[model samples]
Target: MSYLSRSRSVYGPTTSTTCLNKDDEDDDDGGGKTDNNNNNNADDHPGASMKQRTRIGTWNVLTLAQQGKLIQLANEARRMKLEILGLSEVRWLNFGEHRIPSGQILQYSGLRGENAPRHRGVGFLLSAQAHSALMKTRVRNLTIIQTYAPKFSLSYDAADLQDKENFYSQLNATVDRIPKGDIMICMGDFNAKIGSDNSNYERFMGRHDLGEMSENGELFAEFCGNNDMVIGGSLFPHRRVYKVTWVSRNSFTEYKIDHICISRKWKRCLLDVRNKRSADIASDHHLIIGEIRLRVARIPRQEERVGRQFNTRRLDDTTVKRSFTVELQTCAADIPEGGSVEDQWTAIKNAFNVTSENNLEERRGAKGAIQRSKTRGAIYSARQRYSALEKKVKRSCRRDKRAWADSLADEGEKVAATGDIRLLYHISRRLSGAKINATMPVKDAIGQLLTDPTDQLKRWFEHFEQFFQVPARPPSPRYDPPRVSEPIRVVAGVRQGCILSPLLFLIVIVEILVGAIDREPNRGLL
Candidate 1:
């Protein structure tokens, strides 16, 4: 099977569904490489090759009219075997109604608030397979939105300063919401350049610095620099194709306006950026596709820690003196009969072992440095684990409240029917701070509690949700009589007995009559 088909089969739609034609399927099963299959084998089977690399890409599909071209791009990306694809300038109507031409499943978001596209909206499309791989480690909190404020004012006057501030504020807010360590690709026609050649980008933008730094593009560049972000397809060092996204909607002026930026944490993962000539003409904006190798450094659990002795002593003069004495004997072996004064000095220097003593001290310093690094790593790891556990615990507590509430309701119905509503009410009041007793119906109280979960319970539930990673919604309590209590009354003159007990009584009577007969054997009329 071809690599693509194999990947699709292993992680794609079910094998039962055949989107490909019969001929296509034949070609797929025949030509599809087994590399992906081998990857699966490594996971499920033994002695399999490990996945050491992953490739990611990004693209801006021009317009909805070029849907066919978009699909072709997606196919090309798939052909390139991209695990993650970050797409920009994808317009989606209200309530997410647009369909991607590429069959590749997409996780997208609609434009923020109305004012969609703002002129042009930006969206992201990640390969379903890539998402799955990421989900294994951490869930992706991808944010896709469009931001555009006409930078080029009709008048020669510069754009409003507030506009730039507002843009940065919105951008920062959006970025803040994204979970840390998540692979995020923020890309679009930012309508700005990050760096410049002739004029220092920073100097050109005057001292009207607000939340951000630049006037045209330098502000964005500074913001990215401070945030430790990398500009993908940077035309620095050597300019390949510099182009602008907007040019009178008809006039063509090549400018590298549209771009993609990634976090510096993913620096190693960024593999290559291919600015295809075909892609540039495909859209008004040049298509800058980036290929990133998604790699996870498999940290081998520390070798079952061997207990090592910690020594505080440094290489001292005593050790150096001892080494010098040992070298003195060796120096004699090097000397011949009647050597020059220079030769004698060299022999004395060799006997002193000065270089070896210095080398020993440096080695000790290096060891100390290594120890400190390991200690810091351990501390950091511990802190992260603690934070994760704390979050989990909080979530668990929240879930427990609902569970505890349900239990109380079940037990409450029984007590309520037995005129024990007060007892259940006290329990609810104690646990969830909701009172349900003779004065209040259980259903009404439960509704109120769910509607307004107290801070304590809310916190508990949040933690509960975090840990269990499940919705913790309790069912509304209903007064079911069967689950409660009922009065009981016995009917009069009704003998309820089995034959064994009744027969035993009769046997006792016969035995008594026989005993009486024994006392008077001839008494036939008893």
Candidate 2:
């Protein structure tokens, strides 16, 4: 079987259906099936058939602040059947990893500071499959140093020059960190047009590129050349609409500013790259997808967690509350009391768990149900209308179509602002590139960054243990006489960030110190 046909068998129509024919020289619509017989010597490349074909893409999602944008991005990923989606201009505050409700993992990096404005953020959204395949993640200044770069605007100010310098420096550092044999893809909006000229840059770029070369293009080409990376976007032949990545605000101009570049050594793995123009992402930039065929060893899947949460809201009802009270009284009365404190506590906990399980409804899918609202249909329709009008304006340069597109954009924003929150969320997600939570790296006692989640959790535990420990000291004498016949025994565990834990720890310390002071020889010091 040919590489394309074998890839199609694994990824299916989600990618292959829209693919441009590799064999057909004159194919223009960017749609043609791969012929297996065209490349009959498939066995020449040993182990090619065993390789899994993965689709990865990049997009410059202007910003990602509005709610529900992450979910929308995930939806788009599913539609494209992408394993990983690289994002630019995410504009989220700080660096972090957020696990969306849809099981996708989002890792992001941005400017750090409590007072920092949301700007120039970059991230990657991984499908569950990709998340499972992920070996590690490294968050740096701009690069996930594990997986990504942000977009640079087309400006030549002193600040822009400094920004470009810092970006390339960090990018170089990120590339250096990647281990040998690992696939590295550096993609984003560089705001540079390399044009169709491949003269000196024959190895790094291709003649299929669009527009005229800019100064930024030279810098970009130089970076790719130095890194031995292939600009995938420029290598593939596609229609004008499928080649351009960004369209002007007035729909009068378009540019292929966004690009996906892979290491030159693994360039053959990049089977195809093109602009997915029909993807309704609400951004001026189109989704640039690339297909890579790789022979990857399967990683063990993480264990799934299944836990029940009671419907505590049901307790608000008087009848429900009374019934729960009666049930708890009955269950508590039947408890045998000959066990240790821990055993007794466990019994009590079990009683509550059993009672809640029997009496209360499970809060399993309530949030999910709310998220899967009908507003998505409406938002999708609005986007489709906008896309249709955009294409019309581009083709005919019709003033009416351009005006209609602008009006639709305005109307969509207005509806998002005033209409259903779900609709607003979808719109925001469609506009914003990716949704990610702040996942600041934790450091151990020696200041070594803890990257593993397990290590991070352990560090938090160690921190709380030290934080809650009260120092032992020589006690001062007490004036009062002892009145209690028996000592009170108390067991306490500190839960970090809980309001009551600090108060409980303080009370425990006070009791212990007071008792010691009462038995001290020199009480005057107190």
Candidate 3:
């Protein structure tokens, strides 16, 4: 099928997607050669290839339009352990790739206005899998080309045929452009259906197809065969449900139109392919997952960490404070006449760190809390027990923190009794809270604490909005007591020489005139 069927006519919202790839294309300096030696000359710095066993997936996420949904996408990607994920139907504007805050590289293409071109777009979220959290560099050559072809129409007209031809022609040219040494993967919706029959296409496709092959399927299979690419989804055996990549909204039909194919030279890399029905993104198509084993040519290097923090809160004790001061002084004395400024700074830094290490306690609760469970999302009874224990630990930590706050509050009361307002203010702040962490709770208008960063920002916005906008107040009530006639006095007349005399007289005259006008609406300047 090369074009959409007339029956599935364009009615509802079009699918928007994005594609992300960690693999790289050849640099212009390579002169289009596929030699590994030439690719390693430092100039052809390629991204990380799938040289190790890793999971990759593709899904047609209807749209990434909702607020805070992008993080959810990243979280799901992490949960699925997918290193490279190709997305379809991403409704975003602009086209390019950049590293997100999550360290994943997101590459995408979209149109300027409300709708994307041809009711489709490409997006990708390539996870940063380098072992070193500091140096997220990938080295090696590999390419993944994702596509969404025109549908197969009921009437095989010239336009439909021409569109299909254009897609395949471009696809063929793209596949030919990739460096031969670099592994190439082509996957996406092809609008085709190859039945279980794998007659002449056995070299590329297997006998595990979903349904009867359509005209588009025949052409698609022919295209793959000509390129020497093996269809990953068909090679593996799976239940019909697991094999189906798309299901109709009516729940009456299913099709495995989406496929992941790799060049025959790298066929051994693909371990398995299946459809995951549970990964919901408000789409009818199920997520297609594939496992591949790759080889890396370089080992990732990790950067060194420095100046780890100790529990300096212990320094609050008089004894500990005195001990730390003495140790710091001792260390400072040993700083042998420094060589350079940088060296002297380094020595001083080391002195402080060493003294703290020797005097203060080490912090362990947070590190232990995260490292306690290595196997994420494990559903075994052990996982349950670990979860329960984790909650208990958090509760105890909170209890201890509250107790500490209580003690600080009592101390603050004593300081207040001694008229130490500055210390009391600091203590009050500690007893309250600060935005030290993203997960810190902030009270909202309804008295509920909001932990979500977006919600907290909104609450703060509301507060600042009212705080900066001055409010209107009623004018002070004017009082005028009954006056009695008296002789004029000349004692206050000498003040006429003052600079403000004329301005003050003008203000009093204007005020009286305004009051007279208010009492008599017919009064005029005349």
Reference-based TM-score, model 3: 0.47
Model 2, span 1-526: residue lDDT tens: 0110000000000111000111111212224334343223335533222244556788877776644456557877766766567787777666666777777867666666768877666777766644543323211111212212334466668877776666676667656755554555677777778999899899989889898888778888988999888888888888776898887654447888888887888677688899886565457788888776533223345456534546676688798889889999898987878979998888888889878866674222221232233575654554455566446423533454466556656767898778667766655554454443435546799975555458779999999999999999979888866569854444456445568876888888999888887889596436
Better of 1 and 2 by lDDT: 2
- C-alpha root-mean-square deviation, each candidate: 29.0, 24.7, 20.8
Residue 403, candidate 3: Cα error in Å is: 33
Predicted candidate 3 versus true structure: per-residue lDDT over 134-181, tens digit per residue: 122244344676667677778979988887887787777766755576
| Model 3, C-alpha of 368: deviation from truth (Å) | 34
Ranking by TM-score: 2, 3, 1
Shift in Å, residue 443, candidate 3: 48
Report the Cα lDDT for candidate 3.
0.63
lDDT of 1 by residue, 1-526 (tens): 0011101101001101001100111111123223343334335423223223444444555443232344555655555555445444445432221234443544333345555442234333444333222212211222222333235333435346666666676677656755574555555556564434423433212221112223456656765666667665452233333223332222223445555566766544454454543332134454455543322222123334332222213334587556545666666666665779998877666544543444343333332332234465654554445445435434645665678778878887788788876686776675664322211111122332121124336755666677888676899898755533654433333454544656666887999988887888777645
Shift of residue 220 alpha carbon in model 3, Å: 1.3
- Shift of residue 246 alpha carbon in model 1, Å: 7.4
